[model samples]
Target: MKIIILGAGQVGGTLAENLVDEKNDITIVDTNLDPLRHLQDKFDLRVIQGYGSYPRVLRAAGAENADMLVAVTNSDETNMIACQIAYTIFKTPNRIARIRSHDYDCESEQLFSPEAVPVNHLISPETLVTDSIYQLIEYPGALQVVHFAEGKVSLVAVKVYYNGPLVGNALSSLREHIPHIETRVVAIFRQDQPIDPKGETIIEAGDEVFFMVASQHIHMVISEMQMLEKPYKRIMIVGGGHIGARLAYRLEKDYSVKLIERDRERASELAAQLKYTIVFYGDASDQELLSQEHIEQIDVFIAITNDDEANIMSAMLAKRMGAKKVVALIQRRAYLDLVQGSVIDIAISPQQATISALLRYVRNADIVTVSSLRRGDAEAIEAIAHGDQRNSGVVSRDIGAINLPPGTIIGAIVRNNEVIIANRHHRIEPGDHVIMILTDKKCIVDVEKLFQPINLSL
Candidate 1:
């Protein structure tokens, strides 16, 4: 597929990198020459330097015959206009835009129609990140929480602790521990290395385990892996930006929430808007302000400021000051890697979240959802099966019979809204939503092809 990505920033660049490897013709557009040159130097794709909304720029970036147009420039207006131009003038088949403003999102139902803005899909980074954080807080102690199959099933990542019941046990023992609930440990990472999970595989302490289970069984499964944390009550958010304000709004009803904003005017606005949250106007990195707010008693401290350095420092300080957990929103790839398991408990990346949202549209076959995990090296895909045994590789085949790529596992299958844990003997029927985990992203094409319908006519 040929894709024209408007914006050379993090989201656009990462999207290009992901698609370029999957044999797609990717062209990135940007007004800045430096980022464009950097992308061209790093990848095997074309880059055009110009205003992404302009017709000349789109033509230069191959928008005329592009399979997809992804407008993810920083400016919401630019992204929306670029998608409109791609549809009105170029008639691009699929048009996606990253819209950040909440005003547009509130009126999206009426605003994004083909007769209006014409965006086929809208990727809201703030919304995605906020949802992700909400999930983490909802299910305490989970490193990552991603839902699939209309929230019937979820894939959760958690670190194995020495005190856990199944820490030193084999993989098969999980059944004995939770006989009533069905779960599958799809992948395991020890010291940053992938481990193939099997019946005899012994789960070790400090290993990051990714498991899939029914949403109701998430708490039980988490408890078996590690000491389940108490429900979060006191929450502090640094940065009254979109993500922070949205998160505070979501959590205020359930948890005691406090929001700190650097800009006094924005802080006052948020204070007026939020009924339950306490808004403070001060620097998030200020020790005095944090101390005054009783940081040590806070259950979760989330720093989501636009500046990566400020977020990192504030989250680290919160951790040192005795916050139970600290989550920082880091955009830079290097900083994300540097602080993953450091003083910061969890580092959320908007780019990764946005990229995950965009990947489903780019994938072949009937892919319902695509989530990037382990820093893009791994992926959890929910694909719908189409065609019968004669025309599809997966349909009418048992779990063990299907030819899956290396480091890939069928975690679960959701058929008719019922969750079924993957078993070797169970047959996959047509229309089943198959949830899979790919430890190696290079095998993505193979997975896509496996789910695709065969051309019986050929």
Candidate 2:
């Protein structure tokens, strides 16, 4: 695919990096030469140094022949305008824009249409990150939670601890532990390496386990692997940025929420906007403020400030001060590696979350959802199997007989709203939503091909 991306910022750059490896033609446009030059040096893609919204710049980036145009500039208006221009002039088939303003309703025809704004899709990173954190709070103790089939099934990642019930047990023993519930262990990560889970594979204390289960049994299955954490009641958020403010708004109804912001005016604005939340006009890293606010009593402490250093300091302080779980938003890979697994419970990369959203549009298969797991080394995809056995490679094939690529596991199957754990004898039927875990993401194209309908005429 010939793609043109606006803004060489974190989101656009990361999207380009992910797509370039998939053999797509990517051209990134930005006013800043430093980031563009950096991306150019790192990836085999074109870089254009100019205003992304400008017509000449879009043309120079080959928007005329491009298959897709992604507008993700800092300004929401710029992104909207770029999409409009791409539709009007170049007739780009797909136009995706990063719209930050909550006021803009993408679904409203009055706002976006081919005759007007012309954006095919809108992605809000803040909203995505907020939803992610909300899901984590909903299912406590799970490191990652991805819902599939409209929340009927869930793929959860949990880190095993010494006290977990299945910590030292073999994979085969899980059935004995939870005989009533049907769950599948998709993949396990040990020492940052993918381990193909087998019957004899024993789970260690530090291993990260990924599994899929029926939505109704999420909490029950989680309890079998790890001692279920008490439902979080008190939540403290550091920073009043878009992500922090949005998260507080979403979580305040269910949890006791407090927000800390450094800027006095911005803090005042947030306090007025939020009805139930307690807004503090002080620095999140300030020890005095944290103590006065009783940070130690908080059940969850989330640091989502723009400053990576401030977030790290505040999260570490909160954890040491007795916060039960600390989740920090860290963008830099170096800082993320440094903080995660030590003091921070979870370090979220906004870029990774953004990239996951972008993958759904780019994937060749009929993928309803795609999640980058194990830090991009692996992926979990939910695809709808189309056609019957006569034309489909997956439909009507037995699980053990399918020619799936190595390192791929059919974790679970959702047929007619029922969750079926993948087994050797389970036969895949048409219209089934198959949930797969691929540790080797490099073979994603091959896996996609296997799920696609075969051309019988050929």
Candidate 3:
């Protein structure tokens, strides 16, 4: 596949890095020369230094022969225009644009029609990040939460605690602990090393465990691995930007919400727009202001300010001052590496979250959902099976009979809205949505090939 990407920023650079090794011809375009040079030296791809919205720039970047065009520049107008140009002139097969403003209604057909912007896929990083934070708040003890098979199944990651019921027990004991609830432990990470999970494997405290369970059984499975925190009631958010405002509004109904903004006018604007949230006009890193607001009593403190330094400082201060859990939005990957394991309970990169959403479209197979785990070292994919026994590699075969790549495990299958945990004797049929965990991403091509239905002539 040939892909042309606009904007050499964090999201574009990360996307390029993931796709370059997948046997695809990738070309990146950006207005800045420094980032382009950086990408050029690191990856085996073409980089163009020019404005992405211009026809000459697109042509210079080989958009004429491109199979897909991804416009992700910071400006919404620029991205939309680039997509329109790609459709009108280049006739690119796929066009994806990153749009930030909430003004454009995605539900409206006229917004993306060929007569208008013609963007086949629209990605809103802010919306994706906000949804992620909402899921974390919903499940208090989960380090990461992602839905699969239309929300019927979920993949959750939790850190084991000393008090957990199954922390020091064998993996097989889960059945005895909860006889009725169905779940599977897919992967475990201790000290950043992947351990193969088996029936006799023991889960230790401080290990990061990943499991798959029915959406209704998520809380039950989490409790066995970690002590569940009390449901969040008091929430404080720093930064009245799009993500902060949206998250505050979403939580204000169920929890006490307070929003802090450095600018008085923006804070006042947010106060007028929000119905239940209390907007505070002050610096989020100001120790005096945080103490005045009783940060000690806040159940969850989220720092989402645009400035990475401010978010990190504020989250660290809140955690030290007695906030139960602190989440910081760190844009730069370097900053994320520095703060994630040190002070912040969770450090989310907007680009990482956005890249996960984009990967679904890039995959060759009919992938319904894809998520990056272990900071891009692994992935979880959900794909639908098609064709008959003779034509398909997976369909009409027992899971044990199918040849799966190493470091990959079948987690669950969703058939007609029913969740079935994968077992050796279970047979996969046509139209079954199979979810698999891949610890070694290099086997992704082989996995996709296994799910593909090849035409057989009799």
Candidate 4:
């Protein structure tokens, strides 16, 4: 597949990196020479240094015969225009744009039509990150929560604390703990290293465990791994930016929500916009302000300022000042590695979230959804099995018979609204939504091929 990616920033660069390894022709365009040069040096792909929305630049980046055009430049206007050009001149089959502004997104139904802006897909990083944080808040003890099969099933990551119920238990014992609910431990990470979960494998304290279960039974499954946390009621958000404000607006109705914005004007605007949320004009890192608000009573403190340093410092301060949980939005990879699982209970990455949203379109299969996990090193996918035993590798085959790549596990299968926990004897029928976890992303192509319907005419 040939793909022209507009912008060599984090989203485009990471998307290129993910696709380049899968034998795709990737070309990244950017106005900045430094990131373009860095990407060219780091990967086997072409990079053009020019305005992404310019016609000549798209031609230079091989947009004419490109299978897909992804516009993710910082400027929303640039991204939209680039997609329009790709659709108009190049006749690109798929054009995706990263649209940040809610104004554009609200009108997306009409604005993105072929007769209009011509954007085939819209990737909203802020919305994705906000939804991700909302899921974490919904499930108090989960490190990460991602839904599959239209919310019928879920894959949750949770850290095993010391003295947890399942700390010293074998993987096989999970069934005994929760006999009524069906769940599968798909992958486990110990000290940042992937461990192949087996029946005899013992879950140790501090291990990050990934499990798949029905959405309704998520809380029950989480309880077996660790003591389930009380549902969050008091929420505090730092920053009045897109993600923070969106989060506060979404959570205000259900919980006691407060928003802190350093800029007084933005705070006042948020105060007028949100009905249930309390808006304060102050810096998130202000110790005096945090204490005055009674940070100790706050259930969750989320710092989503544009500045990574400020978010890190504020979240750490809130955690130390007695906030039960701290969630920080950290952009830089270095800062994310430093603070994740330390003082910060959850660190959300906008780049990773956007990449996950873009991958489903890039993958070659009947892929319904894709969720990037373990910071882009792994992925969880929901793919529909197509064709029959003669044409598809997965259809009509038992779970144990399919030749899945190393480190790939089939967690569950959703067929006709019924969630079936994966078993070796279970057969995969056509149209079944197969939920799988790939701990090793290098096997992505292999997995895609498995779900792909073979061209019998060839």
Sorted on TM-score, best first, the list reads 4, 1, 3, 2
lDDT of each: 0.93, 0.89, 0.90, 0.93
Q: Model 3 off-target regions past 4 Å?
A: 105-109
Error at 316, model 1, angstroms = 1.0
lDDT of 3 by residue, 134-233 (tens): 9999998998998998899999999898898897799999999888999999999888788999999998988989999999999999988977788999
Candidate 4 C-alpha lDDT tens digits along 308-327: 99999999999999999999
Which pairs in model 2 have colliding backbones?
Answer: none
Prediction RMSDs, each to the true structure: 1.0, 1.6, 1.4, 0.7
Instruction: Output the lDDT of residue 122, model 4.
Output: 94
User: After TM-score superposition, what is the CA distance of residue 208 in candidate 4 from its true location, in Å?
Assistant: 0.4
Better-scoring candidate (TM-score), 2 or 4: 4
lDDT of 4 at 132: 98
- Candidate 2: which stretches are off by over 4 Å? 105-109
Candidate 1 lDDT tens digits, 1-458: 99999898988988998998899999999989999899899999998889999999998888889999999999999999999898989999999999999999889999999999999999999999999999999999999999999999999999888898888899999999889999999999999999999999999998999999999999999999999899899999999999998999999999999999989899999999999999999997788888999999999999999999999998998899889999999999999989997788899999999999999999998999999997777999999999999999999999999999999999999999999999898899999999999998988999999999999998
Find the candidate with the highest TM-score and give its number: 4
The 10 consecutive residues of candidate 1 with the worst lDDT sum are: 336-345
C-alpha RMSD in Å of predicted model 3 compared with the true structure: 1.4
